[model samples]
Target: MLVEIPIIQKMVLYFGNPSLTFSIILFSILLSSGLGSLISGNKYVKRFTDNSYYYLLFTAITILIIGFSLNKIIEITNDYVMMQKMVIGFLIILPMGILMGIPFPTGISKLKNIYKEEDILPLMWGANGIFSVIGSLLAVALSIKFGFNSTIYIGAMIYLFLLFYIGVFL
Candidate 1:
């Protein structure tokens, strides 16, 4: 929600419309994340999951980098055509999309290792869906109230808090 709103807004500013840019952003994220989810079962990804702390740390850092760099990237690409801007947006989001894909399956996989239970995966996904809906609403409200940049900062802070939560509890 946080990241999507700002990126969409920026894309609108660049391209003068929402439909194509939104489709590109949404599809790019979905496709890349689906790829990430599929790759999560790979041996290397499993090895990375073993050190989930560092994985999440890198995720946080990458998100922060994206949040900070997105505006600058838009500025740099200002003269490019709409198609080029779309591609740039996709490339900008692809890494984070892949990283965002990791947590759920990896979390469920880790839990399976410890709990010998199958039901938890569905429960985890359900909880994620609920929070995602709520988070999207909240992100729009925050964006309207505080502006997009602030919303992105708040999103980064939320990720930082998650990092702290993982450090303390996971």
Candidate 2:
């Protein structure tokens, strides 16, 4: 599903080291996940808005831009690796990861306001786990059926569903 991922392949292409490419990718993912967790409790930053519209708007725009740029970013950065790949991945995913994290805290706010108990967190987290597994399964299925290039496009389409649900419905 990573036919559109340049930095990794570029690492492989330039240095021709698969291990380095894999390490670069894992580093990026770990860093982004850490960055995501760091801001997980700060969603109320949008309280300046009268409602959640501003946050939702930002999320939609960010996701849309990221989705569109996924291909072009790969194209443009088709010659980076090692430290270059590390910098590129952080530059790309840092803001996206932060904004994507806002929903978790915002969700906590919503749950607190709507419900009166604490037991729901476990169930909600469990459901999230299931959703993630399903998402991975879908990615594998798409890659199997259409190969990697089309799978990246399919992932973009999947992000649009998130935009529709959270961006519009929120």
Candidate 3:
């Protein structure tokens, strides 16, 4: 996402305002993910919350679909006004962002139960932060060398791998 923003601006929305495009994408992700986080905590969705592997699977598929069809999607929407484009972009990002949000809190909750030690939660959070920083840097390099589509595909693969881990280890 960090890597794809500029690429999207360059390739898909070259004529649009860069700042608006950036903000639309960024805020769409934040808003959708925050909504997802709120949803994941709901008692009504206990069944869904118990099975976060499905969330990861959905996220992987959504990302892969986006990576493959982004060009077509943009081409189809090219004639729309900026506001329409913003909606299109938000819709495109919403599912994956929402799915992405579910896993972290779910994972943390699971870890808390598994490891009763209070310090482990903080350690896990710190590790998550460190990995996020590392992943962002790696994403930049991957996007630079392999292009955004490949980078996105790699991300999808990581989600798939996490699904496997959750199935076996979580």
Candidate 4:
């Protein structure tokens, strides 16, 4: 969304165009991630069968869609109406961020389910933060090699692989 912002602005900035394409995309990016948390929580898990089992699965697929369609979205969007499409893309990227957010809280939930302890949640969160930082660094490096499209695809693939690992082992 960041890279797409200026491109979107340059796509012909129309006056009084309430729909800022780049802004919509950025907002959607945030909104999607926040929603992913609730979507990936235990409440939804119990209500929806096999949902909990596909954390990495959803993340992978979502990222891939974002990768392949991003350029298309940019090229096709008109200045004034572009915001709408950008917002719609939120629906696509939401699962990616939301699913990513899931582990932050859900991991605590799962750990508590197994160990029945509250104190461990903090420790788990700290560890989760550290690894997130590390993973982000790796993502940046990968993005340089693959470009945005393949980067998203590869991220999705790796996320799906993590799911496979969890499914197979734990």
lDDT of 3 by residue, 1-170 (tens): 44344345444453377677667777877888887777877876557767768767877888888888888988888998877777888888788778777767777788988888666988888999998788878888888888777888888898889899989997
Candidate 3 at residue 140, lDDT? Answer: 80
For candidate 2, write residues 12-71 as lDDT tens digits: 554357887667665665566566556555444545222455555665566556656755
- Please give the range of 10 consecutive residues that has the lowest summed lDDT in model 2: 1-10
lDDT of 1 by residue, 49-94 (tens): 6786778777778778888888899888899987788788889888
TM-score of each: 0.89, 0.66, 0.85, 0.68
What local lDDT score does residue 49 receive in model 1, on the 0 to 100 scale?
A: 66
Better of 1 and 4 by TM-score: 1
lDDT value, candidate 3, whole model: 0.75
Question: Which digits, one per residue and each the tens of the lDDT, describe model 4 over residues 4-92?
Answer: 33223333233134365446555755675566566665665535424545545665666676667756665565443545654555554
Please list the C-alpha lDDT of all candidates, in the order they appear: 0.80, 0.58, 0.75, 0.56
Distance from true position, residue 92, model 4, in Å?
A: 4.3
Q: What's the true lDDT of residue 48 in model 1?
A: 88
Model 2 regions more than 4 Å off: 1-19, 40-44, 48-54, 146-170
